[model samples]
Target: MIETSTSICEVIAKLRIAREAPYYGREYAFGELWNALDRLDDREADDESR
Candidate 1:
């Protein structure tokens, strides 16, 4: 699980770089990643509240 999470973070970092460069084609994937991360944050907050 730790390894998987680490890999996911690495992928996100690369997507962020790609998004910034603007020469790497469409930025759709980066936007999706941001939305997914926001959902993850919300879930974590809910779990903590419980």
Candidate 2:
């Protein structure tokens, strides 16, 4: 759980950094971050359903 929390925090930080950037990579980074969060949400939902 600690590791997962840490990873989520890291992804959030990356999202913030990407949002601040003024380049083309920002969109890609945001997409990746969104996907990561989506996966995490799916996992949590599955866990809850179980």
Candidate 3:
């Protein structure tokens, strides 16, 4: 897994490029990537709540 103390999207992009990956899961990698992005957002929201 790609670890970043910074941007997750940037890290994910790098991972995608590194693997030359187009689609990741059942649909496409973009969908998986978007879900990852959403996780980041959810984390931020959780942080704000705390």
How close is every model to the real structure, measured as TM-score?
0.51, 0.65, 0.53
Candidate that would win on lDDT: 2
Residue 4 CA error for candidate 1 (Å)? 12
> Where does candidate 1 stray beyond 4 Å?
1-25
Candidate 1, residues 1-50, lDDT tens digits: the string is 45446656866876776577655554766766676677567666666787
lDDT of 3 at 9: 63
Off by over 4 Å in 3: 1-19, 22-27
lDDT of 2 by residue, 1-50 (tens): 66568668867887897788779888888887888788678766776787
Runs of candidate 2 exceeding 4 Å displacement: 2-7, 20-22
In terms of TM-score, which candidate is strongest?
A: 2
lDDT of each: 0.64, 0.77, 0.60
For residues 1-50, what per-residue lDDT tens digits would candidate 3 score against the true structure?
22323448654775575466644543565565666677777767776787
Candidate ranking under lDDT, highest first, comes to 2, 1, 3
lDDT of 2: 0.77
Model 3: how far residue 3 lies from native, Å: 9.7
Report the poorest 10 consecutive residues by lDDT, candidate 2: 1-10
